[model samples]
Target: MTSIEPEQSSELVLRLKSGDVLAYEIIYNVFVKELLATAYKKTGDRVLAEELVQNIFISIWEKRESLVIINLRAYLFGSLKLSVINHIRSLVIENKYKEYKQVSFQEDYQDTSNLVDLQDLSGLIEEGLNSLPTKTQEVFRLSRYGNQSTKDISSKLKISEKAVEYHITRSLKRLKQYLKKFYIFLYL
Candidate 1:
């Protein structure tokens, strides 16, 4: 596409705005090469560059009547620059999302695996709890599983607060001893 005078350019713009297919074709042929080159050089991806330039042409044709292009060359280049920036930003965000998913999935897998060990330790704790007296077992379950405070347990069971504390402490000590060989002892 050879250079056109200002008058010829404006005339082409008018024809394009009036839905002249030939005028649109002339504009595309003239600038597509330069626009494609700029997009490729800036983005360093030939496929993406071609897609960006194609999108710009499609945009110009679709919005011809609404477009306020003072200089066609400048407008095309500006659109290409903005498209490149937006595409790169989207790629960066996509990569970050993938990384987050990968890390989170691994963490969740580890937690899921740990849950099985916790369940095993829970079973072992329950087994050791049987060795305690019935009253001691009742007090420990009320405080730990039933979410009752020592004072609440005392009021409910009609036992002294000190008695309730003694039972809970005894239950913990017994469970700790029972689980001493396991890593669950660290948490206790």
Candidate 2:
């Protein structure tokens, strides 16, 4: 198995996107060892690094059809960085919870104004929600307010899970964009 050069990896990605198995093999051979090295550098644990590298390769293969890698090396490195950060963060949070029993909180304070703000925001949100497309709004509402899982909504609405996910993601993206615009307008 010949190791593909960095320039060749980009070509391999393009070919893989076009469903070329040889390109996939070439790309994997070139990047897999480097990816595992990055994982080991980030994690400082050989076993865990090996597992993360395995998952990363699996994810890459699974997503090959939709993958558009501008820089395969950078993407792999960034993924390894994020995976390590997530692992460390999870360990920190777990340790904090484990030690929570030893901490004493003798005083408790309550703020009534925060509750009022939440109520006002709830009303304002509902008033503006009608501006969204009906299907998008329904998907957003079911996922956010009705506390329904996407799978549940998909089954309830008789739509594919992908469609449900699309609607929900699109709805949230639009809402965020609108909110940013509104905030800018207010400042201007």
| Candidate topping lDDT | 1
**On residues 16-55, what C-alpha lDDT tens digit does candidate 2 reach at each position?**
8787888767767777788888788877888999888777
Q: Relative to the unseen true structure, what is the C-alpha lDDT of residue 187 in candidate 1, on a scale of 0 to 100?
A: 67
Pull out the clashing pairs in model 2.
none
The residue pairs that clash in candidate 1, if any, are none
Model 2, 134: alpha-carbon shift in Å? Answer: 80
Per-model CA lDDT versus the true structure: 0.90, 0.77
lDDT of 1 by residue, 8-81 (tens): 78888999999999999998988888888889999898999999999999999999999897887777889999
At residue 118, what lDDT does model 1 achieve?
Answer: 86
What TM-score do all the candidates reach, one by one? Answer: 0.66, 0.48
Error of 2 at 4 (Å): 3.3
By TM-score, the best candidate is 1
